[model samples]
Target: MKSSDKRKKRLPKPLLSDMEEIEMDVLSLEEKISYISESLFNTDDLKIRELTFNNKKMVILFIDSVIDNRNLQLNVIKPIIEKSAGDIQNVVNSNNVKETVYLDEALCAMVDGHCLLLMEDSDVLTYICIPKVMRDRSEPINEKVIRGSHQSFTENITENIHLIRERISTPMLTVKYSSLGKTSKTKYAVVYLSHLTNPEIVKTIEERISYINVDSVQSPGYFEEFLEDSSFSPFPQYINTERPDRVAGNLMEGRVALVMEGSPTVLLLPVTFFSFFQSTEDYNNRSLIGSFIRFIRLISFIATLCLPAFYIAVISYNYEIIPVEIIFSIKSSLEYVPFPPLIEAAIMQFTLELLREAAVRLPNPVAQTIGVVGGLVIGTAVVEANLVSNTMLIVVAITAISSFVIPSNEMSTSVRILGFPLMILAALFGVFGIVIGLMFLLIHMVNLKSLGHNYLYPLAPLDLNALKDTFVRLPIWLMKERTKDLKPQYMWKMTNPRGWKKNEESK
Candidate 1:
């Protein structure tokens, strides 16, 4: 048998992912091309060009889909062909060029827009590639803010990193690249403040991402399910936001952010339950106004979860607790309805949800029309038909508005879903059932862990120092240290810059 034939016979029959090694000396140029072609399942877009220069045979291989043809010709082929007698590294003008003996690395590089260079009678293959950077500066549709930076994260990972880097220009700001999903081979980056973040926390998050053994990862949602400590908890363990300013703020507070390619939403981990209620607008406004807004949001959280249930409890079993006139009004509204309070509330709640969903799935202008027209027409028609009571409609409308007050959409949805069980409880045993449900909720939150940190941190564990910024937004100068629960490398974030105030008073 010929030497080339023997090398071909030794090639593995496994998939491309499993074929990690390729001995450059054992495989001739033709055999290497054939091996890669077969490993890639003989895809149609794979381009293989064979050229000869200085009496040496060479093959330039890359997928036509991802690589830029102009770059490959001008930076790689033109240089190599123009100067055929020297090392390819010094000759090629590509920004990121590397040489490796492993076929797996070459395959991955090709998928990521890098072209592979193969030569006969050599034990090393060269890589010629240019980084692709895309810029998108549109404001986020969901996380819009009135003050502060208007820029949001983009689908491109490089641009997302640039957004955060410009905000936090420090040597300690570190970003590490990784690949996930066996088939998709999607790229992701782990960003954190190396000096502020706990080393163990960073290591744990990276390991969890690496251990995700799946065929494909579509979004950060997939990773969240695998990374969260309590999968079934009602509260969100991570905050997903598209605003780069928000991400920069969290990183400054010693949190790790996961930025996935092709996704504008970045995942921030080890978050507290209170984190969902906080927003970038809070920091932009005056301290007192920000604190008041946060207070209202917290009240809304409670109202969203317990308002309907409270109404159900009062009408079903605790009517004596209400004023006589209000009770008469509520009682009269219920008289025309055939179902009980719980049933009446459920109908309106489901109807409101349908409207909300319709409004979301439709276009912006159409969604607004549907939301207003559909809600008013349906609400008025249901009340007039005696299918639902006016009192129940009012309660449901308030509940929906309260749910929308939540800054994080994930937490808002969870809070809305939680209301159903509470309503059911109120129907079963009235006020006692609501109390029991709330007790269980408190228990679950107390026990839940977000990447091993207390989900209710600074509240359940009672950290007095961290509380300076938890329930309320204090003046920026007042928060002298990072949250103690995170155990950040640098506990003191700042000293008293306002110490000069005392000198002014003395003068």
Candidate 2:
């Protein structure tokens, strides 16, 4: 055989039969995709269909209900089958006349709520975009708001994108598409403004995502696990929000958003400590009310964290610091109690925890019933038994209520859990122990970084501009610049809400 002929021909193995011979050659796209889909999407629910259009074969694959099949039939199937003789003849006359063509682009377009058209003898597939009718609904439960827009993200990526696009209409708003999950090949998008977003942040995020190797990722939880800067920290680095307005506001402020398919919650990067205490209602109200509410929440946060520990320390070791009347009152209250103050505090704390857990496990009505019954039964029983004093009950109740004052559920839970440790320390070493715990907390928080940005920004790093909006929302007119730490190109989003002429007229 000639050299070219020999290179094309494969040598036969003596032990293997012709039927079992392995071919060392490049596989077609269809064959490769067939192998991958069969191996990866090996489930009863997964649907894959091969249909012919104008004598050209194309494969349609998607998870059921994840796509609207009715729309696909009308837009894609009808378009190809109803084509006249001229259209069929044109593709046949063109280059690369194969009887069947696989259009990957068309498949991707269809995945994004479009219909794909694969023609015979054509490498290019046409994407006939179809507008999917999504079920209009209120905002997601976890992210519900009393004052903001109620449109929540859907399972549909297209609808989610539409929600974001509607809020941020600027051309600078950009979306970069990518896929993860080696087996599922689920599509995800990293959205941010080009001019406003820091290039280094984008690069770091892209690199982190590109390196993810997993079988399948179901929701934002998987993405969070993959992208979190520190796995050990109780404090969340990425802010997860289901509200589009929140996401839009962050994007405008120069933060990036990672939106995944099949997940309503979007992951926000570079969050600071103060952001946790904020709610969407903060901005919707008047400045005076907003600032007051913000201040109250900050105070509540500190109170919740330190109250139990401080109380424990005062009664256990710092009784000398207490006033004579208060000391006499506290002593009288503890006289009937059998246990020490620490033991009493522990009993009350554990009882409250058990009640909270039981309530959460029950249904809404049942949970309410459980809370009332548990509270009444436990509170009465404890005081009657003299295991914990009535005064201690009030303090524990106030502490629990204060914990809930934090708007973010995750932060509240962390604070609740962390309180136990501080309470223990205070009981052992008194006021000095509480101070030590606070110092440690401050150091840890100041050293923390969320996606490479300081977690305690505007306070630890001390940015005057960011402080205007962090602890308090200054009036729109008084605030001219976007957050400086965000590195936004347009520092001045709007010149004072009151125009220059209005200011002059007032003067």
Candidate 3:
């Protein structure tokens, strides 16, 4: 059998080191091309070929789909195929090849999705670029916008990076790629503005990522384990966003962004509680409308947790607080109910949660059907069955809706889980139990720190200046300070762009 045919029979070694010895054994250019082609063919869609120029033979190889076909046809294949001699001068000018003996420099062209052509006696390789397959369009699940770009991120990491780069074309934007997951070998990149981001924070993040030893790092969330200060805490240390605008805004604010392979979400480091509540929609709309919606979100948060417990405690134990007419109406509502206050409330909460879980798991059309039917049937049947008081049912329904008001799903889940403890305490010790539980929760929040920054910043640490942007996002111009409570050494951000503006005449 021919050497080329024999080489094609064997599989390519997975490691780069194995290829070096094999390359030496394959004396002929055809044998080398055959070996490389055979090795990587099954794993990747590789294009391989052998070219003859005068007496010298050159082998060319590349991942076919990854490179731009036009560039390869016009710049590489045509030049080599049309050449008539071993005259290095003619090949160099005709092919636009910069080097005749540097293999590493020639291979650098492959990083841009190009293929390389290697010759006998010549160290240089010809690089042919081509295009790659792309995933079909899918609506963005995380960064949904009613107005603005409809294009969402894909599972492909390169495609996601392309989407980001297309938006921010600034020269200062930088991307540093790294690998995690010892076995999975998942690729991820740290993107930030070199001039805008803090050097200390970047160094800290890079150092932390380098030490990560895991089975696999598939998503941005998986990388969080290395970056986060407190894992056991309920709060998320990194802000996961899908919107390029939000990532760009955060990058401009001295924060670094992480994009991992297969994960559509971008992770922003050193995030705050105030940031978790913010949605891109808030900024997309008018400032007045945005502030109004934010205020409602804050109100809903307070209501979702404490409202149901307060209602139960007030009606069952603190009847004196209710007016005579209101007390009579409440008593009448519970008259037909057979279950006690606590049991009735539990039944309602449990039923609502079950319905919610079912709706989420089912198909959208079916989920909507289930929601409508479940609400009508359960609400009427429970009341008619004398299972729960009408007033308590209304309170439970309102509380459930309020929980959804939280912008972050993690925060919403935390709020729901935390509610049960408050509800149990309210049932056992009237209003006093609620107060004690709340006091404990307050202490936990105050003590909680995400990435060494207080979770309840400006509220617990008492940074009065930070408050203007915390509970309320003061107008851009009025905000004149940085959130440097983390004692960040590089405390320079264009926080108040207009503050330092000199008079027009001074310019």
Candidate 4:
């Protein structure tokens, strides 16, 4: 038999199923094209257009729903057929064009909206970049701020990078792209400032991303789970945000951000427990006002986590802690409640959570209606029915509102969920149980790490300098250096804006 015939005979019979193991050199053009078609077997939108180029057979493959047809017609087909360009490199007008001899690599490129060009009797396949459809950038729907850039990230990774680049146009900004998911081949970018960011942190993040071996990474949340220090913890180790300005701000602080394709949420790493409480609005407002609001958010954090438990302790075992008049008022309200304080608080809190979830899944107008109607109707019904006490309702309502004040939704939800365990503790051992639960929580947080950095920085290790910006938003000029916990290469953000005073004294 001829050598060519022997090579064709060696090719795998189940081409699509065994394509990963099949060598590109052993397959003929006919077999390769057949394999491509069979691999995308059930996809009806897969388009394979065969045409003549330089009087030779050529084929282009792409998904009809994703590729820009205009570019394919004008830039690709027009140049190849009319200009008689011999190679795809000379014809296609794409920013990214690559030749791949591996079927797996070619398949990935084609799936990511790249047009694949295959020529007769050629072992190489060329991939032409054709941009996919993406939503326009708009103001963040969830992470809105009173003052800051209105732009948020979109589903497109390139567009998100463009938004970041527009803000930080320096050469120090570095973006590295990688593909995750063996089957899905989801693309993501790791961005950081080369000079300002710690090299070891960048290396650690890159290494962790490289080690993420999974069948699919659907979103930044999925990726974060794989990289997180503790999977079982309810608290989020990384801060996830939709606002580009937030990501940019974090990046400027020597932190790294993970931007995934097809996901609007970006993950900011090496974040602290206090970081979730801080908002872009804090910087937008004046120092005194910002500090006041920051203090309120911190107070809300404690209230969300401990308020229900504290109430359970007070009403069940420590009623003496209440003032004389307050005790009478509470006693009067609880006289009608048939259940124990624990059960009453649990019932009210669960109802609040149900209403919250329902409102989120409904339309805006309908959601608003549900929030107002659900609160009034449920609160009144429960209290009148003696299913819960008025005091319990107020406690649950206050806890819910406090949780909502947290800037990070993930942290807020975690805080709300945490109340359940604390309530259980408070019921079992009263105030003592609450104190023990809190101590355990504090220990866990101190031990937790975000990207190998402490999760409760400045507070756990006790860095007084960093503490200046943690609970309170000090004046920007006072914060002359970045957080030392992050170990940034360059710590000083500013020298002194009021340097004229020092010069005057010297003269």
Quick one: best lDDT, which candidate?
A: 1
Error of 3 at 373 (Å): 1.5
lDDT, candidate 3, at 273: 73
lDDT of 4: 0.81
The alpha-carbon deviation from the true structure for residue 262 of candidate 1, after best TM-score superposition, in angstroms, is: 0.9
Better of 1 and 2 by TM-score: 1
Best by TM-score: 1
Give the 10-residue window scoring lowest on summed lDDT in candidate 3.
8-17
* Runs off by more than 4 Å, candidate 2: 1-133, 500-507
Candidate 2: tens digits of C-alpha lDDT, residues 1-507: 121221121222211122132333443437534543443223222355666755556554543323456765654455545663345324222232222123333333333444333333344434444434556766667655677777777776656766776676433456777778879998777888776777788888988888888998888778877887777777777787888888888887788988888888888887888888877778888898889988988888888888888888999999898799988888888998888777887888888889889978889999999899889998999888888887788889998889778887778877887788889899999999999988998998898888778889988789897788877878766777877666666576664467557447553
Candidate 4 per-residue C-alpha lDDT over 1-507 given as tens digits, one digit per residue, 9 for 90 to 100? 232432212222222233334332356667877777655442334578888887788888875545677888888888887777566687677768898666656765665668888887766678888855545658898888888888888888777876775566443556677789999999888888766888898788878878888899898889889889899988899999998788888988899988899998899998999999899999999999999999999999999999999999998898788899999999999897789988988888888889999999999999999999999998999888988888888888898889888889999999989999999999999999999999999889989988888888888788999988898999888998899988898787776666676447553
Q: Which ten residues in a row have the lowest lDDT in candidate 4?
A: 6-15
- TM-score, candidate number 3: 0.71
**TM-scores, each model vs. reference:** 0.75, 0.73, 0.71, 0.74
The lDDT values for all models are 0.82, 0.70, 0.68, 0.81
Assess the local accuracy of residue 466 in candidate 3 as a C-alpha lDDT between 0 and 100: 75
Better of 3 and 4 by lDDT: 4
Q: After superposing candidate 1, which stretches have Cα over 4 Å from the reference?
A: 1-135, 502-507
For residues 1-507, write the lDDT of model 3, one tens digit per residue: 232432211222322223232223223555545544433323223556677877677666765435545566665667767874655445533434443223333333443355676767543445533534354756667557675666666676666655665555433456677788879999887876665566677788888888898898777777786778878766676787777667776766667888888887888887777787777677667767778878888888888889888877886677787789988888998998877787887888889889989999999999999999998899999898888878888898899899888777777777877878888888888798889989998898888776666878878778888776666666666655467664433454444467454565555
